[model samples]
Target: MIKYCIMILAFIVTGTTSAFAAETAVLQDAVTQTNINYVWTILAAILVFFMQAGFALLEAGFSRSKNAVNIIMKNFMDVGAGGLVFFAVGFALMFGTTAGGWIGTDGFFLTGIEGQDQTWTWAFFIFQAVFAATAATIVSGAVAERTKFTGYLVFSILITGVIYPVFGSWAWGGLFNGSGWLEGLGFIDFAGSTVVHSVGGWAALAGALVVGPRVGKYDDQGNPVHIPGHSLPFAALGVFILWFGWFGFNAGSTTVGDTSIALIAMNTFLAAGAGATFSMIVTWFQFGKPDAPMTINGVLAGLVGITAGCANLSPGFAIITGAIAGIIVVYASEWLETFVDDPVGAIAVHGVCGAWGTLAAGLFDTTAGLFGTQGFDPSIIGVQLLGIAAAFLWTFTVSYILFNIIKSTVGLRVNGELEAKGLDLHEHDNRAYPEFVGSDEFIEGEV
Candidate 1:
């Protein structure tokens, strides 16, 4: 009887242990969370990809009808060609193993990345690939209607595969190896104001410089001449599309599906609203009209401004940041137009505002901001300035050289005939509006 009782007790304990182990295994599989992250990140990437349509419509609408097809083609090609080049070389340079905290030296052609549940490598690639294309496409607008499609293609490949990725490695290398000097010094740029927008903005400035302004952009006395877009409705629609996509742009940077997404999304909304309101008010008071172009750009400026600290800033601060960005876009656009001929206001909205947003992260960050829990850390501000300076210098100098090279080698600008005739026919042999072909109705100097 004693032996039998001992055996029964052993069986009960063993059975109970086995049941608990099985339940724990089921829970672990259910809550692994990596698969969920992959899905969220991919969805965000899809939204960002939709922004390419926004950019195409925005640039096409802002430009002459004759150049609309060319603009659309360039935007389309950038996504295709830019993605391949970034996947082939840029991703490796950006996210591979680090060398001295400056660059990555592995994963070329995407060879070495592997995992079971952490199969996020591909999803991450798509997200970052869209971002890479965004930086390259910004140049299309600044040099629109005048650039050679072939030359522009080369520029796009180089920017995505080399210039942009190198700088991205400097600031974001930690994502791969925890080995970037800027990150080591606690320099935080939450979503890439400097990384994406400023880099694109500076490159756009360089391209504009190389290609020169569009025909009739400036008069004999060097005063800018107003060249209205073909359709304000299209431009407005593009702005709205961009606004919608930006929620993913900011919130998706979290790289996970979590509660913080709600806060980030709200902050994004507030800043964009503030930016639009303040810019409209400023333009209404200054120009005697609520300028539609400036107002649309102001909304973008606010989006770019708040991107850096969207996760770290409060709703009120986000509004202040965006409102200031809106106001700044007006002044910066006017100021840049005095010398540089940026047709789309890319310089002001992305480059200058991007830098400001990056620095604003230092001032308003809740966790490590100057006024955050740690309180009064001047070093964060210093680091932010350093990051901004580094971004401007690196992006500008390299891009200027690249543009010059492309200009001298394959030629950056089309012939003046092509400029007057419209790139749609000259470059693509296609017309966005075929009915106006061979008619003086769409000519540069005509009504």
Candidate 2:
């Protein structure tokens, strides 16, 4: 009897210990998942933050010698100004509490948020802050030569504080809390095609229009002039950096740590490569020569096109989308230049390609991916069109009003003589390369 009792006691104790161990293991796993998500979110934010450098370099390279420093300064200032504005007001308007699915009204200054989950909040803000700066910087390139430094600073504040945040609220502010009519209608932007890209693109269009074409960009007959950017090598470097940073821009949109990230990164690269290749071939065939600038823009077009559907589509579909974007960019650039006179192909790469990316989401979304696989919804397409239209009208109208106001008050364009001498010497009172005067660096050697 004693032996039997001992045996039973031992069995009970062992079973209890095993159960306790299993429960502990499950709890540990949950904690680990939370920590992993925190780390990934921070990492992705850092990557997107670095894209500012890419933009700085790209814009600086494309600008005229007189405006190089001004271009770099504009890019830098936008980040600083936009960051402060977004933190103070933009974040609240974008991701705060929902009000009739229009805008947010809480989370101002990132206040009252606590715990590890708050890391996700910070990540979202920083990533979006960088994007807002990007949109503002696009206008910098468009209004490059003549825009006053002080005026550009004010515009940056407006973009991050009001313009970008208002639109962003509609699409991503959680106002829908993930179930609003627009979200329910399946307006799957995945990333900001209309929200970020088109916002910037349209603002750029407005700035270009208000500022007018660059001096000598058009002849007496109104035909477009071909003024090459000062530095091809610098432009190429900028393109590569942007391509590298895009891995984070698109893949990071998953907003979570998962195996899906790998797939998203792959799709990003595939689309960019396909875009570059197709643009190279198309330029060679159409223009009778392979154009470098078009090829770089092709890469950007592909990246933009893939961004809206990167998480929702197959790699094959991504490649197709990118190639089409590449071709579209070539024609769009030509057409817009003829009609609107964009200086840097911003309208083509960001504006036209952004629309294509948004529309592509409706057509190419597959149900087999991690985000889910529901192919081609007509309703989604309609919603996307609405989103696109809303973005264009809102951005254009706001920007037009802002520019006209600035034009009337402070004047948008500089004096004709100041422009003729280049804004660099007249506005900034400095030369990009004073030491390179009469040197090989200043002369065109061999192309």
Candidate 3:
């Protein structure tokens, strides 16, 4: 009897010890994963943050000499304003607890986000915040010479705080919480094709529509005029900066530093190179000269186009996708100029190419990709179409309403005299180059 009792006690002790060991192991794993996720998330956030510089240079280079300072200011203010607004409410609305499959409810002010597997959630918001800012800045270029600075600031806040987060919630937020229709439909936008680019593109379209054409941009006959930007070197440098940042823009969307990132980075590089190469060739063939601006825009268009499908496609497929995007950007920019006077090609690069990228995801996703691995149905093409339509309708309608409201109440455009005199002098009371001030000959002839 004594021997049997001893044996039973031993068994009980061993079982308890084993349970403790298992619990410790689970906790360790959770902690390690949390740390790893934090590091990767922060890194991606930094990369996306650097993209603001790329945007600043791009917009400054694209605008006329009279609007350089104004462009730079708009870019600077957008980052500041958008970042604050997004942190305050946008993050919650985008990634918080769900509502009726449309918006998020919980997480307001990032409250109670601790100890949760919120690494992905935080990183996603930061990266997406930069993209929202990018979209807002695109309109700055389109309305560079004409928009009121205060009015533009208000628009940026509304977009980042409400417009962008609302639509973004529909796609990524819904997917994160497992209630999104997109997941049920097997829709895959590994990054933000419709989420980021399309949202921005639609907003740009609305702003351009409301702001009207720049002075002398269209003749009385409605023919478009050529308003060349003042600085090609600046523009070229801006393109290079944007290209460099796009590595982070596309590859960083993976949100993790794993072997998959290697594939994504390779695909991104191939697409961008193919875009620039194809655009250069197309320009030489079609326009009788290799246009520098077209080449730059082509690269951007390709980058934007491939962003949706970067992780899903092979390098070769990326090249083809990017090349087509490059060609489309060239023609689309010209075509849009006829109807909407987007001075900086935002409509072409972000709008038209953004649509192409979202659709391309449906075409190029393969068995090796995320969709195939998950046994998601092949009806993703139709789902992608739905996402595109939803993005277009929601973004256009909301943005148009906001812009019209702003126009009727506060007015959207500056006076023509202020536009011709330049916003640096009239809006801010400072000149980017003070030496040239008070000289009409330099203002009229040199510019």
lDDT of 2 by residue, 6-118 (tens): 99999999999999999999999998887776677677767777877887777777766666777887878889888999999887787777577677767778885433256
Q: Write the per-residue lDDT of candidate 3 for residues 181-278, one digit (tens) a residue.
A: 55456666777767888788888898889888888889999999988876777877877887777777777776665668788788788888888888
Instruction: Give the top-scoring candidate (TM-score).
Output: 1
Tens digits of lDDT, candidate 1, 1-447: 999999999999999999999999999876767667778888889888999998988888888788899899889888999999999999988877888888888777777754312356778888999999989999889988889999999999999999899989888877754256777788778788999999999999998998898778899999999888787788889889989999889999988888899989998898888889899999999979998899999889999999998998988889989999999999999999988888788999999999989988889988767668877778889999999999889999999999999999998888777777888877887788876654423464452
Q: Which ten residues in a row have the lowest lDDT in candidate 2?
A: 438-447
Backbone clashes under 3 angstroms, per model: 0, 3, 0
lDDT of 3: 0.78
Among all candidates shown, the one with the greatest lDDT: 1
Residue pairs clashing, model 2 = 366-373, 367-373, 367-374
**C-alpha TM-score for every candidate:** 0.93, 0.92, 0.88
Q: Report the C-alpha displacement of residue 324, candidate 3, in angstroms.
A: 0.8
Candidate 3 deviant stretches above 4 angstroms:
1-33, 112-124, 174-178, 368-378, 437-447
lDDT assessment of candidate 1: 0.87
Q: Which is better, 1 or 2, measured by TM-score?
A: 1
Off by over 4 Å in 1: 1-32, 114-118, 437-447
